[model samples]
Target chain A: MKKNPQTAACLLIGDELLSGRTRDANANTLAKALYAKGIELIEVRIVPDEHKTIGNALIDLKVKADIVITSGGIGPTHDDITADAVSAALGRKTVEHDGAMKILKAHYAAKDEEVTDARRRMARMPKDAELIANSVSGAPGFRVENVYVLAGVPAIFDAMLEEVLAAVPDGEPETVYHVTGEAKESDLADGLRDLETALKGLKIGSYPGPTGKGGPLTIVCRSRSASVCEQAALAVKALFTAQGKEAEIGQGDRPA
Target chain B: MKKNPQTAACLLIGDELLSGRTRDANANTLAKALYAKGIELIEVRIVPDEHKTIGNALIDLKVKADIVITSGGIGPTHDDITADAVSAALGRKTVEHDGAMKILKAHYAAKDEEVTDARRRMARMPKDAELIANSVSGAPGFRVENVYVLAGVPAIFDAMLEEVLAAVPDGEPETVYHVTGEAKESDLADGLRDLETALKGLKIGSYPGPTGKGGPLTIVCRSRSASVCEQAALAVKALFTAQGKEAEIGQGDRPA
Candidate 1:
């Protein structure tokens, strides 16, 4: 039976990432989390912190995927224009969220610090949006429609993601099986092609190690149906066997 | 004087990436190299190994960027469909290039192995493409029009990029200046907005560190003209000074 898998797209907004100053850790974290919940991360777009770019990208991605998650540009800085961008994209007015304001005010007051205007900026969100609790930092992330706006800092982004993921419904989890062999990718390409043609709704992947890594090739079979994935895995092993090679299951090939 | 900066985009192809199995290293490497060569990396798209999806994404990115670079899916495997996708996107026929075949043959011959059909698959390229020398591996990458096809292996990708970058012309190098202060992004947000309005053709960025990393905030000014960037940096320092906060120039703010 075919399963209609929910799809997700990531919009990583940061000029630091494009400038090669900061390596992205959020995409991989989100991709893995979404995968465990059976949500397919179909595409990831890394764009700068410009207002027009962020707004346009959000609109485009929202139309294509079931949900869109954006990271960065949510800090208390002049460059933190994600709230304004989301408002523009969704055609809503930016307003101070009551829940967000209360949380920020309480956190700052408890610490005996005055809540500055820049600190208050974090409380603003698109009208009619729900707040996504930020446990790591006082500033909460707000969700407008299908888009979730989170903090750019890695710690806060990851923490806010936990809350976001809990609120979304889970889809069919994908079953993945792996087989490793001493054969090269070229040796099994044709057979793998035929096997893929024979099987429906299954994906077969071949990864070869670099030279001096001892000619190790891994074939991975993935599908929503466990039986189909298992059968495809057997066929892959048979192909290697026919070529006078041994395909070992669970041989600990490097992930991806 | 405002200078039109050349921009580039990267299309990272692989299901492994979407599956959250492999963290991407090529985009950062490529982004840094492009920045050094004065080509701004405006966007990065990570997609799965599907042919139609890859083809459609390629066409879209090619139009928006002056140059496009794709990494991964050049291996001798069924899942390595990047060449076919490129062919479909550009409407070019896939053909075996003589130059690539010779390199594969010589590399295999030295190891006393026959050049197998699957191995020969690496030699195939879009018609009228120039061969990119793969010094690390025998399988060569190729260039068609403005797109450069590169291997997914980090070693091979880095080596092939050296050749690819050498072939492309460099643009005006962007001059960047930094000012770091104890002030918060909120403390400087208003001044930054004013400064951005006064200066044309310059980008101002504010980056704040996470909690316990202290209340350090960095302001970056970037422009093609060194004098403009310097003047903007001084103005930023003056803003911090007017707020009774010391803004130090070249205090080793992390390069973005």
Candidate 2:
């Protein structure tokens, strides 16, 4: 068994998210993107824009995972304190990065505008940071060691992630085999438990979902090995079949 | 200045959420619900179904806020390790509560079915737990001291929250005044910074949002005092008006 699978944690920093004023679109977006690259997002922590709180949470998340990514607080506003907070967490000083400022200036220059001090805020990051290029917007995110500080805006965050993902070494992506059937989650619980114990390194999840679309329940088998995933799926299908329920293998578990 | 607004931290547990197989609907739902009840949701932590991870995360969150609520992992399945993890977190032994067992049996009895061992798993909780009633589903959630363990399903979680909210003492609910205008977030950033400093204990947020629906950007003022919120809102409106933009004051920031 491989000891490492590339674990990551996300620190979602924003007062808007904590205040219930904004539904955070970034965590889910990052989760999907990271999963596609085979990085197991082990933990996600959402903290307000308070300086000490952000710093403390970042430190906590940093200790938990290999790559720690943060969304929000990279913008050009008072609440945008993610860079400074992350810097403080690492016991480093935040300074305006020349590369980031050049990007910001050019982005604003294209709009025939000067980069104001407010706009300049986007350039400030940890002193030893490497810029994460933003394709959607001009303002760039930064990387300090394994930590990636990203924009809170969905478009820019998504755009910046492509650059970040390019730098990360992808692990063995889990092979998922999803089977849906008439068998309820509880009906297959015992049999699924036995299968889970029997199959080493195979992760199984049973979801109680929509009724009319396909079936009432879904049993998803995921593993690093394709053969294990297939075996688990077949066993799950047999569990449903034993109970006189019809089961179907699908492309993926995302219900259409 | 009031120091304490009843604070809450949520621990969302599920492998499906981490794997990006499911989008978590509970955090936003709980955040809005808690906010409406005057509870400041200070932090949210999402951890997968691994036993130590859940327990450790739960213990960590329990220290950060006045109330800790957990969503997911209370089902009748192998992956439903939340109750056991939480029980272990508190250094308490897990036992099948008679009351919970009674509820589970009654629920199954209503469906003219016997409660299987798998169904019996729902009754297992920490020794010193109080039942949190579930109106939507028959299985009851448990509260261990300040920590409330609830269902992961949106509808069931929402229903269980009603009872949880009823028990929590309300804080001075933050009053929100939303102003939308053509002025960009950076256009008002410097002036908004002054307003934030001038107004003691007022929290302000600037969101870059949709155009054509109403306007380009939104300025939200939130404070425990309604008067402070109003003053901040008016100040924000004046800033937009100063920028030659139409500013509209509205009930809340949920865009129409």
Candidate 3:
């Protein structure tokens, strides 16, 4: 929003999702979180748990985006190869993280379950990686270079990211103003076009629906500067009022 | 489900999506549609209208993925440059498709709007492209080589894809069977492990969820073959019932 803002990309990994067995909810959640933090979400890619595919996508995103976050493929089963794939992509070796293992062992011991060799696989991390504390589950996430490797499961991933996002520097996220009134897009097209041309950096979009004196048109005006957003919203209101349209301008947030 | 199935990739082009100003409903819809048609959705990428980024992603996807479907950046607006970027990626010249131009001109004439020079931009297509008729909107889509380009808006894109998908040959898509019962993944861990080891081609994963039968797990059996899927589902059903757990079988559909 200020100058040369940092950008992030997301890589969703898993065969179950590709097969349509699982409807992923994390991508949208992470997108919303990053947007609120002012980090530009440049791209989102969903790939199967294949080494070559994941490795290639990671390398590609690394060259373009400032930060990359990956979710899924970190389980005890054979298909969970996120750690291994991350290591291969970064040209590093996979090693056991003692701290992660300690946490996992404690979790299993509390539940009175034997920590078998298969379960220990969850403790493995890429070389020179920092562990992200998982509050929902004992299996910790890891960060190598600018790539943050996280689990696939929703609950655990959300908890881990809550802590991870706290460490990221905040950028200046754009504020939004909304005005929903009964007006056809065609009726407001000229004014919207003129407003868009004048706004420059500010974005003015009209979503149209319904038909009547007050046609349903949801106008969103967004900008990095709060004053700019307010000014644009006021100008839009004035134009709509002049056209004998009813419109209310307010901050774009949940009504509740 | 067949061996070495044809791969498909999606290129979502729009600045609103990258800036977190819009939620992408097209990717999931396209993925589900492609799956039903037996086209393996290999990768999905969200790229801005920037020429270099779109060109690079298009080149990479075209080489790796057999079919590439792109949405957005084909409208009349100045920001719409998907056609130009795609042609650049393929090292081809941008040219106007006569048939598309005629249809667009007719549509504008019917609406009584002047077909300005800016509106004519929508008629431009890359050389050697085939038009994919749009049912909802008059702005036709284009297909060049293995790349299928559609509008970024959901309604128009969906209608255009439905028409285009009918022309493409259907490959074998993966199928699935769901077996849920009063069971525990840990309890079935060793047995499921043996089954996974025995079935080389079939994929069996256990999803732990709230069991209505006072149990702790819901195992999902998936395979490329319906027979294999049925066999896996039966085995799980028999094993769970024998273990004094209530189990039921269900079916699922997945893209190849």
Against the native complex, each candidate's DockQ, computed on alpha carbons, is 0.56, 0.53, 0.28
Please state how well chain A of candidate 2 matches the true chain A, as a TM-score.
0.93
Write out fnat for all predictions, comma-separated.
0.61, 0.57, 0.21
Off by over 4 Å in 3: A1-5, A177-256, B1-5, B108-119, B182-194, B209-224, B235-245, B253-256
Score each candidate by Cα lDDT.
Answer: 0.85, 0.84, 0.77
lDDT of 1 by residue, A1-256 (tens): 1133399999999888888877898999999999889899999999998889899889988988988999988777678899999999899999988988899889889878767888888888999989988887688898888898888788889899999888888888888888888886777899998888988988888887654234778888888788888898889889889889987875222433
Encode model 1's per-residue lDDT on B91-195: one tens digit a residue: 999999999999999988998887888888888889988989888868889988888899988888999999988877788778888898888677788788888
Which digits, one per residue and each the tens of the lDDT, describe model 2 over residues A1-256? 1234388999998877876777887788888888888888998888888999998887777777888888888777787888888888898998989999899889889989888889888899899799889877778888887788888887778788888888777877888888887776778899999999999998888888622122478888889888888988888889999999998876455445
**Residue pairs whose backbone atoms clash in candidate 1:** none
By TM-score, highest first, what's the ranking? 2, 1, 3
Q: What is the lDDT of residue B133 in candidate 3?
A: 91
lDDT of 2: 0.84
In model 2, where do residues sit more than 4 Å from their true spots?
Answer: A1-5, A210-215, A254-256, B1-5, B210-215, B254-256
Per-residue lDDT over B78-148 for candidate 3, one digit per residue giving the tens place of the 0 to 100 score: 46688999899898999988988898889779888666665677789899899999766587999988899
lDDT (C-alpha) at residue B175 in model 2:
85
The predicted structure with the larger TM-score, 1 or 2, is 2
Binned by DockQ into CAPRI classes (incorrect, acceptable, medium, high), candidate 3 is acceptable
